[model samples]
Target: MMTFYNKQTTEQKEFYENLLSSLASLSKLFSSSDTPYLHYRAHEILFCYAFGANNISRGDVSFDATKDGVGIGLKTFLHGNGNTFQKIAEFNSVSDEIRELGSNHNDIAHFIADKRNERLTDTLSITSTKEMLYHVITRNNQSLNIAECRMSFVEKARIKKVTLKKNNIYFKDSLHEYNFSLAKNTLYKKFDISENILHSIDVNIMGNPFQLLENLSVFDTKESTKTMEIILPLYSTSTGDVGRSSGLNQWNASGRERHQDEVYIPIPSWIHNQFPDFFNYKGKTTPSFMVKLPNTDLVPFKVCQSGGKALMSNPNRLLGHWLLRDVLKLQAGQLATRQLLRQKDIDSVLVTKVEGKEYDYELDFLKYGSYEKFEESHKE
Candidate 1:
């Protein structure tokens, strides 16, 4: 087992201290006063922290003329050269690579659509960042490392043109609009123009420019061919009074109206590709992630310690564990959480409405003999 050490070489010490300082700096930026430039402020600050600590490697934390600079292009930054920052994606208690972006070893480059939607902008707030830091820093050998996470939101866009410029595919949503009706808008979207998270557009870390695609799929064009897939029936009004209805006479009876601003998640195809298991043979089986439906459950410190990115990534995985531990009251060392699927249950959920911008989500579950029953059924 690796024990904590108080001593280290000058370079090692610099790397460690740089991260410590970066954390402090980021914390201050997040907790400080609000501003229209909050997005820009946090973005640059995160870049500063990531770039500074990234250079601490190879004995070069001091800003030099070479790879040690954080101001490198986005293309270069993704290439992982002078600096490293944690990429955020929902994950389990352990670390997993959801996707790969340009490594910063080269030049840094990033891209923003002339009209990128903004529903998941508030992700910059410390609520999500804190979880990311806890796992990326505190969990792994307690050492600071490079990482990042995917942000999400809703966007209602009309097809303009499918253009492929600069190796980045951009499906521009002309006149893109977002809903800031309730405070919920603050939960995810935050493009204050007055406050933007984007540090610089067309940022590439190593010449690996961000690929801009016109649509989710090249085949999905202005004429459109694909159908909207509901990953999880958003938790909206119930299926009764304002629930999802089904009837012939009520053909239009599906009264539920999607926010004119369709929900959109900004995870790149690379990162989005990580959750294949969630969709694999999906129509056949749905992952019934277990949640400890305590009337007023806390954010279980164990789960929070893993960080929100981790919490979001494999929600089903951790939810399974919570069932085994909290609900089943399993012993600490007895066993790890078991992955289970609720074929019927998941199928039913397919029609449920999701509660957008939930602090914590609630889902249907089996009351008694659930974990054991699932375990025994899969014994084969």
Candidate 2:
């Protein structure tokens, strides 16, 4: 379980409080008896959820992570990417079904209370309780799917340097020590702030808590250095995919160790398409990052560790993610180049490459180890 901090800098904390209050009040305006155009209010509610990530990923860590765990940043993308969200109104093949359902529900709500006397189909239709539950589950599933798509990209990436301190709970591994903060810069690129600001005010406007030095003391913070990392969950994302992406948590654990007192640099993802140069920091080599599939045994698979070495026995077969500028290269001809994908040499045993069937972390986690490792050992 990744825990977040209740403590925060004053400015970061206040900005979050104001932003959250705005989101909540905007949502309630929908349920008002005098609400104008109910459907429009619903859109407003969604907009609040979608474009409001900086707030959710800020302030007290626990509160911040909850919003991020869902796909609340969606409004930002939907708005920026050529109004792709408005397509729900146009009802294209890929977007119509859900929107139609929501629209229909609004019509029903409008009709049942026309100030007249038409309490008619209360016995046969999808009741409000059923509708509410349906919406909850549907939104949750959608959020999960959105996450899969967002993490799918393994383009030019970067690993931010992170430090772990005491009284912080972290997932234990067999090799490297790891810690998580729902706050800024942990799994995202380090933000740039002035030296006077970093030392005196000490906060990240970019919402990257992993870069907060007055609040952090593990990684080396030598003048204006960008030290962050990428997260190594079981999930992987490539281009042009749909639905919830998968992870590799089924066949193995990170097998890394966690420390209660020791300080170590962790990894985060790249914000832009590039990253900073690497140095040989202890534990920066093997603990917090790695690339392994569900099965097909490989050795010396040290993607993240204390040293700056790639350190893999079968580098070609393993699908590890690295800071974009760190290890990936363009092959010249192929239009769709790849990074953080399965290595080239390792034999792929695909009985059938279906969802949760071949190599993903989440399915394996939910079905096997957390459930009991489901195996069909080969007789050959």
Candidate 3:
């Protein structure tokens, strides 16, 4: 936690505090903002450390750097931004090597940031200078502050190339024309910019880089992949007209009048690779996939894969029949609340949408589960 302060007299301190208060109040005017440039740079620096690479440099290889000739590409993500780290297929030069590395590290130099008070809360007001704090989380759910950095914006420019550049770390969006850059890092943007700052960072990271990468290898191994359980929460819509199609198509189709809230969840290839049986396997013999909601018995669920993602499809009345009506106890003309997905022994609580908002759900890779025994027990 970084505090805002400086060496100043009483009058100077009062003036500074007043200025900060005014800026905080005025930040509510803007309607939208892009991902902080600090996030991209922090990701790059973390990647360099996670994969045993030191001193960043430009390259045609898949990785940003190397360790003993092994090319190491770094992929990073924020805690709440969701967990689908992607390496654009077109940008990867050494495809095999990249895939090999991704498979080796579960396909990422995965890192997550902790939620902080100074983070941008209002989408309208954009003026902020708080340094981001991050914690590197392992597959075993161990969290340690391995990397923390402060950012400064450099410049913004148009992103002409679709493929990745050597030093280009962040691109705002594929849909946007102009992007922002910080020194070598590049991030694209869809929305129009009005004098947004170009972001840069000063980094402080942990441990011997190689040792951290080596410690993470246990998760990347083939043995770590197994049939595991995952809780997929499905949220209901907030409000609508009497006959309006509440996006809850699954529920409405089953003679229920509930609206659905759509959430885009990233299904990383690593998850598919690890839980191939639950995600990739298609057969009738698979166990009764029951979703344990709050105060409800396990309701039936069907897991399916599309692209590199997995979704719990409720084809029948599994959700509407029991969980929606009984557990949630939702009714017409009322605000539909969110549900939870939990496993047998894990302490983590995963929701369809955090804060009950319409944002994408951040899939935690450390949390996965199996239903073989549960299915057997219910077979009678």
TM-score of 1: 0.19
- Arranged by TM-score with the best first, the candidates are 3, 2, 1
For candidate 3, give the lDDT of residue 212: 47
Q: What is the C-alpha lDDT profile of model 2 across 1-380, one tens digit per residue?
A: 11111223456545543443333333223333211111323333443344332222211111111222332111111112211211000111112222343434332222212211111111001011111000110011112101111111111122122233342212222222223222211222111111111111111123322344356657654533222332221222232111121121111223454111111111223211122322223444433322222222222233343233222223422332221111222122211121222111111111111222222111011110111111212111
TM-score of each: 0.19, 0.19, 0.23
Q: Candidate 3 — what's its lDDT?
A: 0.29
What lDDT is reached at residue 129 by model 1? Answer: 22
Model 3 per-residue lDDT tens digits across residues 22-84: 322222232122221123344455444433333222211122333332322333333332222
Give the number of the best model, judged by lDDT.
3
- In model 2, the Cα lDDT at residue 87 comes to 8
- Compared with the true structure, the alpha-carbon lDDT of candidate 1 equals 0.24
RMSD (CA, angstroms), candidate 1: 22.8
Give the better candidate number (1 or 3) by lDDT. Answer: 3
| Model 1 lDDT tens row, 248-328 | 011123356522111111111221244343223222323323222222222321112111111221332333344334333
Worst 10 residues of 1 by lDDT: 56-65
